[model samples]
Target: MAKTFERGISSIPGYKELTENMSIQDLPLPSELIIPLRQHIGAPNRRLVSVGERVKAGQIIGDSDAAISAPVHTGLSGVVREIGSRMTQTGQMEDCVVIEVDPEQEKVKYTADDVSHLTKEEIVQRIKAAGIVGMGGAGFPTHIKITPQTKIEYLVLNGCECEPYLTCDHRLMLEYADEMIAGARILSRVLDNAKVIFGIEVNKQDAIDLLKEKLKNEERMEVVPLDVKYPQGAEKQLIYATTGRSVPPGKLPAEVAVVVQNVATAKAVADAVIYRKPLTERIVTLTGDAAVQPGNYRVFVGTTLAHLINSTGGLKPDVGKIIMGGPMTGWAQKSLEAPIVKACGGVIALTREQLAAAQEYYACVRCGKCVDHCPMALYPNYIGMYAELGKYKQAQEWGALDCFECGICAYVCPSRRPLIEFIRRSKRA
Candidate 1:
């Protein structure tokens, strides 16, 4: 039985034109990289490299023994010019290791022809050492997810790049379907051979078809076409859509015998276990009205957002805002200096006029539109109201913390109320 989702927007403005005929391109190495020690959700990694130290590409410059954290590696061979604090896109000031690229330096590649002989525990260890994390924008360490307290039943791969203006995952599915499948197999092994499913949106028929064709010879895996809705790619929503399992509020998917991973994360697992590549780089969609050249980019993790934009033909003169990810759920950047991290899936630049025209906030009009459109079935209006009054406890009672901050409520609010922002504040409070 397929679990049905209640409410979500079917169409997003300015999304269709961006993904059409998109292909992956590599951004040439930048002159410098500011690698942050805190890219994952857990404890920040401890700095292992100091200023003036020469480091090779893929070398771990930061690590932590904390069970929840992931290591940070240098994306390029360079000498550390500075090691200090810098504000990331998420507004946290973190220790950033600044490296000046050594153009003459040669990169060392690590590849293993045979990883099938390795045990499951050894494979997980390799993934942890490589610093692989959820690349679907959450940045949860992949090793921690594979190591579950509950007995796993289902392993769902999120190929639903439902977020608007992001096509990197779509391209990855089309180009790296084999890698993704291989990684899924490794993940399944880690979970004692849990059933695997690929959950993708119907809008990406190409990716779905490609994966299906590739899986002809494969077994124990299937492709699932999800509704073309905002937030369909969200972990909980994907789990429910594919497996008919709803994760309890404040509970994890593991609680429901489900383990979810992004397609890119799966591919990274394959790369780490087979090719010995670290999580030093990722595919990022650089698109929007302000982008002179909009396409998917294979970018190094620590490269500056500005450098990425510039390398890809630079931004338009009328650019107003630069977002670190997709418009709906991505964080707005105050400056382009924010380095690309493991979780970043796209860098979007919108013209100021366009942003201003689209965002005209007004007071909530007591409309039930937000409630109707909320996929989580939480009352956004009441939560926003309670949050505005600083009644966080009341907001909590209304399920504010349960809100995934998908921005759908705000998108549907005719009054243009920033419901997601209010709910976020309440969650933090």
Candidate 2:
């Protein structure tokens, strides 16, 4: 049986065929890289290198003593060109370390480590030193997530790449299943060998079948096929769909004895623990209708969107919008200069025809479509209205902060109201 959350728009097109079948390819290093120091959600990292300083690949360039933050590393050997503020994918100006790529680069060698005798704290320290975070767009540090104070009973692996036009996680599941499973086992060991359940969407039947076959002999791991729906991969929704448990509002999944980690994040963990590798690169889906060559590329962090788009064949003449991540919840890029951070999974180039309907929006008519489809079951209409009037406190009273910004409200709204934008404003306020 395919499990799903109570309510969310299922009619949205996935558009995943563009690159779902494509194998991951390595992207050529760009001339320059703009690596942001504060890629995770917690405290910002202070620069550790000065301009004109030469650094090696996988070297920590930025770090913080804050418990909630992760360090930043350079993916390529280069000379520090500048350290200044730049606009990141989040649409905010953050401090960045600019590195000019060297014509000749040094390669970092990784060797597999024996984890049989490793302790939980050692595993967590390795993960933290590797700078691994939630690669499924949340950008939360993984070390803190795995070290919850409550006893965890379930470890949910999010393989439901529900957002349209994004197939990086699906590809990771298909190509790196063993690595992901190994990483999951590592995480489980840290969590006292909690039962690992993989919640994959039905749309990726191949992944589900493969994982099921692989895990049939494993007693502590199982695979659950999830109903195809937007935001089905969300932490709370995936937990409910897999375990029939609900995480209360303003509460973490740990409250319900559950912990959810993205499939890509698991893969990174395996690399970090087994091979003692740092997270300096990730598989990014360079896709969409307007892309000349739509495929998945293993891109280094700090690579610019312009370099990626130009390297993989530039966009079509009719391209109207370029977004970082999936269309439903991704951020629209105003300038191609924005660099790819750890959490960036896809770069979509939509044609003018595709974005035509998104040009204008009107006042909400209270059609209740947003309420009917919101996965969180919060009142987006009232929140948007209150936020539009700058009544952020009222918006909070209507459950603005609880929103994960899934964009289902704006997607199903009859009046085309930018409910996600308004909700974001309210949260910021």
Find the candidate with the highest lDDT and give its number.
Answer: 2
Candidate 2 residue-wise lDDT, 99-136, digit = tens: 99987887778989889999999999999999999999
Clashing pairs in 1: none
Looking at model 1, residue 157 earns an lDDT score of: 95
The TM-score between candidate 2 and the true structure equals 0.99
Best by TM-score: 2
lDDT of 2 at 384: 96
Q: lDDT (CA) for every model shown?
A: 0.87, 0.94
Score candidate 1 by lDDT.
Answer: 0.87
Please give, for residues 132-168, the per-residue lDDT of candidate 1 as tens digits.
9899888999999999988999999998888888888
> Candidate 2 — which residues are off by over 4 angstroms?
none
